[model samples]
Target: MESTSPLFALRNVTKVFPGVRALDDVRLELYPGQVTALVGENGAGKSTLVKTMTGIYQPESGEIWYDGQQVTIRNPEDARQMGITAIHQETVLFDDMTVAENIFAGSYLTRGRFGNLDWKAMNRRAQEILHDIEAPLSPTAMLSGLSIGQKHMVAIARALSVDARVVILDEPTAALSHHEIHELYELVRRLKARGTAIMFITHKFDEIFAIADRYTVFRDGAFVGDGRIEDVTEPELVEMMVARSLNETYPKVEAPLGEEVFRAEGFSHPTEFADISFAVRKGEILGFYGLVGAGRTEIMRALIGLSEQARGEIYIEGQRVSVRSPADAVQAGLVYVPEERQQQGVMLDMPIYQNISLPQLHRTSRAGFLSTRNELAVARQYGERLNVKTSSWSELVNNLSGGNQQKVVIAKWLATHPRVIIMDEPTKGIDIGSKAAVHAFMSELVQQGLAVIMVSSELPEIMGMADRMIVMNEGRQVREFTRDEATAEAIVSAATGVRA
Candidate 1:
């Protein structure tokens, strides 16, 4: 009972960026009342194609057809007017304004002879949309007062505000909790029922299978294939997206763990977490798992003194240490590679070698002068060791792909010679191939007597890589499991605070 023609279609679309062709005759078709899953690796041009669709960029060549007629989208305004809307991974919203104002920021309801802004109309409509989505939020509430999940609801309402016919959700569940993700799925179903064409872009295979009606694969910026979602298996879809079958992931290297290298005792924060304690041995990989707001990240931040109010006792190499700041933490042989790699990990504007040499500048200085030779040598050694692909050492950190940038951040910390390395979401936004490489490198690192504490939301990653696991729930350490004792079911049960 499906329509023969697509509601929106991009045919033979091409987009070129400088020397690179971002998209090469890529094609996408979104049928009415159907969810099309756009599958791709990290650099597979999904973002580029999205920009074209939302009119952020005009394609080099292609035809965009809507409702059986070709349409020209000149800018974002034009796209919005054409009923095309996008809810990006991190929706750009104003923090200072009310929910209603954020929803109708540019296109507000106006009335009267002078065409004044109609605040009452906007608020009422915003409240109606919020009610329909089952989001209990006030239209006049300040945007900053809302939680991450509530902010996602406002973004969805904004999409509906434009009467969007083509709704694109780009990694919308990246920051959502379990309940929030469920609510988002319901909203997606509601949109589909209204004959809205939805393009769902996500990397999670389970999500793709759960909701997608059709799947379109893209590899290296070109269309690989398209078919019904039920017609393809997970492995087959991955093969299409990556152009090769992936081996068993999480190549955990099992090495002999040595004496405890790092320990946290009575880790407590008044509002964030309470009574959290753990220990990691040298040559060991320890994983922390939890849903959002589980206080895993809060504890990590406090470990390195980002949270001044956090009280904790940290011991390094069997010696009591006082870490008042990240600098002190580094001096105590403890370093953290933060989760927000783009924002907190690497300095995007700096060159790769400079970013790598940032932590250990004293080692790269001779006679009170920065030694470019030594800096480049340190970067070269680690880049080769980590298999970071780059055109040149002088290239800006922003120019490297996600995997290579991650390498640069790790290299920055490795230069510091820390006894314990805490990696928060080490492989969060990178591609599958890069994930394998990072995993292999992590194993290699532990083999050299380094203690690794990895905090990840990915269950498979935690299960596959960690020698021991710790589950957190509602800002408390709920359960601990050795590698032999851990299973997906038991771990999830504890992390979610289920009494089974």
Candidate 2:
């Protein structure tokens, strides 16, 4: 329930960077016991706003008010002192430290004449906080031993230690499992019961609708709208974030399946996946559906020769091939577009053209030297094809937005001209428009007789774009479904090992 008076407020805030206006005259408010969701696409002002609130970056203009009193937070310590703190998607905990130590790291409890550390009191308080949240965690346990979800629980316990009134969670559930997410929801409700004001920054609409009481939307470094969650629809929220009414989020194009292009027989990783037998034909999109630990990505990695000791008999165009390394896989007309595009797919510091032309250096070179003209042409060709929004071909991959960087990754893979292309989580962190573009591009690829294998956690994406799909559960292929046969329930059941 929202109170008449806001617990914290950001009024007319403006923040600017060297080349961009990160935030522009943005206004936001959080009331006691209310869960306020901050919704935005990647590169929106949400991050800037969070930084400003958490004292990471001071606003060039405007004011911050807490409990009806204006305040200036010079650093993170000041923000924490004022009952403001945040938990990021990545848990920040020292591996060598215990849960209790991490919870009271900086603000340690001291006692006795010599002012020695009071570990007993801190451990007791940590246990109380953990019990309050119903988290089954030991305060004396090493932080390194806990799972990702447990680490987040410890972070929440830390917030309670500081008596946090305004707690900002930035993509907290991004890496959490379904069960863990539910646990987090229960913890959040407990926080609300204690009159804590929560500011949730996330791109997931499902989570927003599930937990948020009030909603605030931001677009292009400006405040777009704010309202009660029940008052707004998903499409309306999408419009607010992307500034476009995307009638069709997935542009799936139907194409006739051609002759078999690639096949894997009894592919097995010692511990990852076992006897994964599947085949993809030319002009077909094969979707791999599974939970996080269901071996979807491991199968792809093994297919691309990234997993050592992976045993599989691969066939390309009915001929047996040995994939001993990534080069061998490429030579055998197979390429993988990895999920971690920033770390593996694209060279972040390199120019867009260089990243695009990297795999095609042989074709883009005359003798032993590379041809700049050929490089630029290849980059321009796929850049235009993918509709990458960039200032110039020389723009560094790091400078591009998440969606555009994904485009660059796809363009680089397409440049390889692989017969079998494996795309892992192709649109994981991109916006709807970019996702549609990538979907359309996949359709185009298959239409041109290029076999595609797509590994995705998003059910809607798999159902929308895949011609055929397979569900993996605990290192095994459990079931197969055609586009018409795959349902949310069926796929999820198969992925979770529920024989339905």
Candidate 3:
């Protein structure tokens, strides 16, 4: 069958920043009634291509064709005018506004003769859009009152309300549950049926096979592969994404666990979670498993001193420590890389060197005078060690790819030289190649006698890397398994409260 005419096409596109060519001679096509999966390793220019398509950045060279006609998308408003909309990985919602208000923030409906605002019409339309996405929400509901999943639904409703012909979803399911992902897939199918073209950007291979009809791979700011989903194996796609073989992606390491390095006893927090306890031995990796709301993250936060109402006895190196804040946790040799890297992990506006040295700034300074040379040395050492693909230490963190940004977060924590590292969803939303790199780094840390506690939602990841596994259900620990005992079935049964 002849391929359907592309609703949009980018030819010979090139985007350049001060010292970086984000995208070079990249070509992509989006067909109506089909979903295209955009795949690549971090700093491979996936985001840059998306930005160019969404009018966040203008290409230095090339043409964008929509409906077989050349078009100039100068701004986001222009893109929206042309029936294109983007739902970014990081949600952009007005927290204080109601769902309906946020849905029509920049463009609100107007009523009768007096030109008064049509609140009723707006609410009804918002409700209709939310219902179309299978989101259970009230138009009057406050954005601040919703969970991360709910907020994402609101964003989707807003996008649907625009009635866009081309929809771009950047890691939409990153923070959603399995159930919510199903709902999203249903909505996406509906959109496809209505002839909407979708550019689905994600690192989850399972999702690509499940939702995408076609695929495009990016490597080092260039197009590496493009074909139908059925024609590409997951391994082939991953290889194209990183431009390397999987066998060589991760480094080799073997850890020999020693005596207990840190312990949490009877940890509890009222709203977030309750009655959590775990221990990490030197040179060991303890994995935490649960659904999105299963208190895995809550317990991690409490253990890392990011929770205010948390009550627990934290023992580090056989000495009891009081950790009331992140600073306290760092003082106790406990470092946490938060889930939301952009918001909590790195300073997007700051240079890479500054962010890498943020946690250990005191170590690089004397008499209140910061030492640039020391900071540069530390940043360079860890940056290269972590394989952060950046042009220079002075490059802004935001300029790097999602995977590289994550590496910077890891680098920052490593600068502190912590005894115990708590990584919450460390590999979440990263490409397969980057995921393997992160896994290799975790193994290295364990071999170096650094106790690591990882909270992850991906079953395969937990099964592959964890030395020990702890499953949580409804705010309580349900089961523990050693590496040999841990399996996908066992972890799922324990996490879902189903007896095996």
Candidate 4:
């Protein structure tokens, strides 16, 4: 099997962007009737590779081979004509349009009577395609009422609208339920039996081991390795993606344990997560570790009242507190630093001082107006405390690097003087140096008797920084571990729902 070449392959692909060579002579192979798992860490050029395959971006120099022939795909239509299609996690589908209309949006079938759009014929074809794919969706039914999993079905139906040979699924199970995921696995098996090549892109190990025949790994924009799924273990795959061990970096300083500072009681979202509860003590780093769709971020959002309908009660220092909104959470001495720093963390266009003081304007204001002097003073203090390297307090956040920008966001929240700070994916998108700095700052924070809740996907980061850990799977708290008990093998198994 290793000696035989695949029908579709990308040879020596090189794509260069300004200040970054996204893909440096990368290679990928997709064979007919097999599922290939495309694995990588964040910013490892997985998305760039997908774009090149879909004709969304052309490689500066590379060869795309399909059906035993070299091909040139100048646009999306060209890719489609070559029997290539993709179904993204957030596929573009119109809610008001019928499933049939979405299936044949760009290339509508037309014939009969007045040579106009034959709705009847199109509906008939759509019904056939849906049925063929084992999708129990109505062709004439409106897409608005469909669930996320159903929308994925519609997306698959649209892909099968033509004679699709290669299908790319990018994180398609990120929002699906447990049952929906099972159904999706069955669909993948059916597709495999039909001789369709599949590229399954996800961060879940369980998905890869369950559905993939072969595995390809990319790290730092270069190909690491590829082999049959059964030949290697999960830890070996992780080692390929990380290219480093737990002891490579991360500075953690243990502080004396203190009393409880924050606690959650029975947190539940209607569709996201349920029955979630946890506690953080002063001078503690409580880490939440899970796979991409395990609802960790959703729980954080609900805690800060972003999900209005989510039911949850919170406590601070043994007293019940109201957290019905962001303001309420802050007022109760709790604050959240979101994972998406550019959008939810800081005001990118605003000056560093303004962005830092914006969240605490009420406290920094006098006579119903904010004083520029007070704002600058408040920003200067926290900025220096966090070691934020900026040209000046008046420097715009957009001008700073990703790490500095993250520091500015942390400074803004710290100015509010909260008891417990929730940092979601705190070091994401930053370099290793920046991550170490963040970890050092977290240690300093806990040493000051401030409770910190750090949510991260990196196993080493969680193990290095977390005094205690909770692993969630499919919207439920499946397991918990202390610093002494946390290990890469155990955490991955629990996060992937494998029985101990």
Q: Write one digit per residue (lDDT tens) for candidate 1, span 1-500.
A: 77879999999999998878999998999998999999887778988988998889999898999999999999999999999999988889998999999989888899999999999999999999888777889999999998777888898899888888999999888878788898889989988888899999988888999999999998889999999999999888878877666564578878988999999999999999999988999999999999888999899999998998999899998899999999999999999999899999999999999999988789999999999999999999887888778778999999887878998899889888888999999988777767777888889889999999999999988988999999999999999989899989999999888975
In order, the Cα lDDT scores of the candidates are: 0.90, 0.90, 0.88, 0.88
Model 4 per-residue lDDT at 456: 92
TM-score quality measure for candidate 4: 0.74
> Whose TM-score is higher: candidate 1's or candidate 3's?
1
Q: What TM-score would every model get versus the actual structure?
A: 0.93, 0.91, 0.91, 0.74
Runs in model 4 lying further than 4 Å from the true structure: 1-3, 113-115, 246-254, 263-279, 286-324, 337-417, 423-448, 453-500
Error of 3 at 135 (Å): 4.1
Clashes of each: 0, 0, 0, 0
**Which candidate number would show the highest TM-score if scored against the true structure?**
1
lDDT of 2 by residue, 289-348 (tens): 999899888889898888987998999999999998899999999999999888888999
Model 1 poorest ten-residue lDDT run = 241-250
Off by over 4 Å in 1: 244-246, 399-401
What residue pairs are clashing in model 4? none
Global Cα RMSD, each model: 2.2, 2.6, 2.6, 5.8
Better of 1 and 4 by lDDT: 1
Instruction: Provide the lowest-lDDT 10-residue window in model 2.
Output: 242-251
